[model samples]
Target: MLSATDIEVSLAGTPVLKGVSFHAQAGHVTAIVGPNGSGKTTLLRAMTGDLPYRGTVRLGEADIAAIPGWQLAAQRAVLPQASRIAFPFTVLEIVRLGMMASAEPPPERRASEALARVGLAGFEGRFYQELSGGEQQRAQLARVLTQVWDPVGPEGPRWLFLDEPVSSLDIAHQLDVMDLLGDYAARGGGVIAVMHDLNLTAMYADAVAMLAGGRTMAQGAPSVVLTDTTLSAAYGCDLRVNAAPDAPATYLLPHMARRAG
Candidate 1:
């Protein structure tokens, strides 16, 4: 299990998160949802040890901060909201960077397999800077995929922590990436993503944590936390959640929101 308790984070002497607690079981896709400046990214960064906090975060039975950096990289890979490259690197070179932490060199096929998984099959020789925004995002995802190739390692179940992973993708690629994440979770891995798309979160996440005013307003199954009342309160808008008879997942209808005044 991955768990955080009483997590408080401050940036530049300003408090961002106030006593936030969250937990996710293995083999599940857990989504963190909140409005702008609601501390979603801050909380995720803290959990991944990219940011410092005054709370306890445990991955399985060990504290995350205490784990060695290489061991941590072996167990989990992170995909940030944005990535920039100064040097012009080939897609294959970028993907191969993921395995730099290992003692032995990684085989060429591993990188190729990761690229294919992200729909970049033969783009290995393409320049990273020349790809479109969505393609770059997919390439970055492929890099992380190669890092933790096996969802479950001998140490334990590995993890993927992504921040707005599909933010740059089109609808088709968005669904494809979400399906891949779902498949990873189904294979006993853990996925915790900071998501802005409520409908996607409802469809893909096994659990949802809603944040408002730097605190977690609700955390549970999407059906329980994605209600009209909770969503409206968190986003400060008159939002509605609807289910369609033809579809299996719930969808958000932002157009149905009325002026609150």
Candidate 2:
């Protein structure tokens, strides 16, 4: 499991995260959700060791800080919100960068398979600068997948830390990527994602952490955390949550204005 206890972070004397704690278990998709500027991305950055933080972050039994850089890379891969390649690099070349930490067999084959997994089979020869925003996101995901190809590595379980992974994708591709991550978790990998879409979170996330005012407001299963009251309080606006009898998912919508008296 990936666990953080009482994580606190500040940027240039400004507090961004305040005593936030959460666990993302192996074989589950854990999502961090909140309104803009609520520190969801900052929390993710802290967990990934991209930012200095106070408290403990553990990947399984070992403190993440103590783990060697190469070993840590082997165990976890992070897909940031955006990536830019200054020089023109082929898709295959970008994906190949992921294999730097591993000496796994057949490097070319692994990269190709990873591309195929992300629905970019024919993109190997394409230039990174030429792809669309959504395609670039997928290509980056493929790179991370190549990095941690096996969900359960010899060292233990692998992890994916994604920050707004689907923010650039269309609805169909968003679902596709979420389903792919769901499959990764089902196969024993751990996934921690900062998500924006509440409905998608309800459908794809096994656990949800709601953040506001730099603190975790709630954490639990979707049914428990994605409630009308909790969401409204966190977002500072009235909201509605609907659950259909025929479906296992919940839908969130803003409360419409009432007629004037």
Give per-residue CA lDDT, model 2, range 1-261, as digits (tens).
Answer: 999999999999999999999889999999999999999999999999999999999998999999999899999999999999999999999999998879554457888899998888989999999999999999999999989988999989999999999999999889989999999999999999999999999999999999999999999999999999999999998889998899889898888763231
Error of 2 at 69 (Å): 0.4
Candidate 1, residues 156-245: lDDT per residue as tens digits?
999999999999999999999999999999999999999999999999999999999889999999999999899988898778899999
Error of 1 at 133 (Å): 0.9
Error of 2 at 239 (Å): 0.9
Candidate 2, clashing residue pairs? none
Q: Cα RMSD (Å) per model?
A: 1.5, 1.5
In model 1, what lDDT does residue 253 have? 82
Clash count in backbone of candidate 2? 0
Q: What TM-score, over all chains together, does every model reach? A: 0.97, 0.97
